[model samples]
Target: MAAIYMRMLGYTVTLTMHGFNMFLMNNLLQGPVMEDPNIRTFSAMYKRFFTVWTMFLQIFVASLGLTSDYLTLKYSNKKEPYWLGVMRSMKNRLFAAILWPTVFLVSTFFWSLYHYDRSLIYPLFADKILSSTANHILHTAVVPLVVWELVFQPRSVPKSHAVNVAMLTVYMSTYFFVMYYTYLEKGVWMYSIFGIAYDTNICFPLIISFIGVMLYIYYHMQWFLTQIVWQPQAKIKM
Candidate 1:
């Protein structure tokens, strides 16, 4: 979905995919190692292996998605059975839901990077454009893509509200900590809303509250996609 949107928006799909992938690998692996000495040695080794694995995986998925889209369009007139049409429509919608948020997040990050000093960005690799693009593909594209597939795919049962909230909390907390670390290390603002002049003495608490609110919004969006879009369609008879 992101690829399609990017293509429609006249951005290079390859570059967008590459940028997102690099972002994920750097954040999940290298960022932790750099911030915590306890994680440095083993985490560094894991990061190298994970980077290679992720690169291959992203390329394969991107190719597969493009091929699938091509085939779907190319054979659209060839009269599919009712079930096939239903399946195809569901697949396409699911792809769109997954793709849209990724593009939103990646575009947001990229725009932020453009406005702020590179040094101030989290997932340190994003500081360099090439590295940042790679990071974006890995982090922004691959990780989220896989996550959507595993956790939010059409056949998967929706998680309970408690579980959903817990998962969302953990995810937001990790991002918040990483952002805080990035701010401390660079002594510059990456996100203008949380700029240094905001007075950490008061602003820090507000920032934390803001993240909680954002997480709630994210969860609600996920719930709406799963419950309102995918599941009802899945239940309809072809």
Candidate 2:
């Protein structure tokens, strides 16, 4: 019951944050900023952001699987084990196992970088782009929601840790390559750090190093959470 409500609350908060982000961008970042070709580009837009993408998927999966939880909570009539039914679909598991970790990983890493240097990670008009409300929801509130799921609805870290890391690498590499080519073509860096002057040789290596460390930490952290949450209570046979 508590977990359900907590998930519901998280969904509500995420939805509200998304709405607030749109309102700010549409209303505040008007005139020239909105009309900037660089900003208007797909890579330069909000959806390109890892934080925004994770939140978007969280809301998307939550809405798509709403009926699963709804039906589970709505009745107690069927009793053949929850896993025996459609509740245990691959989509649900992937969303739970892969998609969920991606969110936490992105959230955790972004916050770490933000703390180290806000200017590098987020720019001057970040508030106008994502809004303070949305930022907190993505960076701060995301922690609690992640902890809530970890504490209550924990899932194991996937055994294919290498595969997971490779997928994440591919994601970052694609972004980097696209942004790199775009910069070559248009003389604009999608991010401040992506410019040829500073980021030429060392930038990618540094980012890759960070990703490797984070992936290692993610596996261990998730393993710990699963241990703490999913351990069976000792039976009292007295």
Candidate 3:
């Protein structure tokens, strides 16, 4: 009952955050920024951001958690295990394996680079375009939501770590391909780091390697944290 209520709260929060972000983004798109022809040409790229991708994943996992929890709570004595199993599997595989790592990476990387030099990941001028509230919701609030899910929701290590990592790789590769394609089309890199004048050949590969390492680290971090949460409970039951 407690877990169900907690997840319901999380789902509500995730939905509200996503809704506010969508509202802010819509306003930005339809507002004066679009009046600038140059900005308008690149406005479509906003959807391609990793933060945006993780936000969608967050909402998905939250919904999955809420549904699975609700069913479990309502049908505790019933025998409808199939759908519950499916929902839990999807939530564990997608949320624990992929979403956590990606969200962690985005939040950490964005804020770290943002504070060191905003121009690398996000431009200083973009502050005027994107409100601080929206920016924090995207980059800041996301971390706590993932952490809250990890801490509050009982989770097991994903059944197939390899498959989970493969899906993450595919998602990441698609984004990289998009960035490359955008660069080819517009003659400008989506990120300033890639546009650096020196040693441009090494930039993309280096960044990709770094991201791969970070994601792997965060994946293991999630596993370790899950153990911390569930291991003691398992022992007590035994």
Name the best candidate (by lDDT).
3
Tens digit per residue, CA lDDT, model 2, 62-164:
5544445566576657665565345535434545445556666777767776788766667665644566676777766766655554554535545455655
Pairs of residues clashing in candidate 3? none
The runs of at least 3 residues in candidate 1 whose Cα sits more than 4 Å from the true structure, single-residue gaps closed, are 1-132, 135-152, 155-159, 174-199, 235-238
Count of backbone collisions within predicted model 3: 0
- The parts of candidate 2 lying over 4 Å away from their true place are 31-44, 79-92, 95-97, 154-186, 196-198, 233-238
From the highest lDDT down, the ranking of the candidates is: 3, 2, 1
Q: Can you give the TM-score per candidate against the true fold? A: 0.41, 0.71, 0.89
Measured with C-alpha atoms, the lDDT of residue 60 in candidate 2 is 68
Where model 3 places Cα greater than 4 Å from the true spot, the runs are 158-160, 197-199, 232-238
Q: What is the RMSD, in Å, between candidate 2 and the native fold over all Cα?
A: 5.3
In TM-score terms, candidate 3 sits at 0.89
Backbone-clash count (model 2): 0
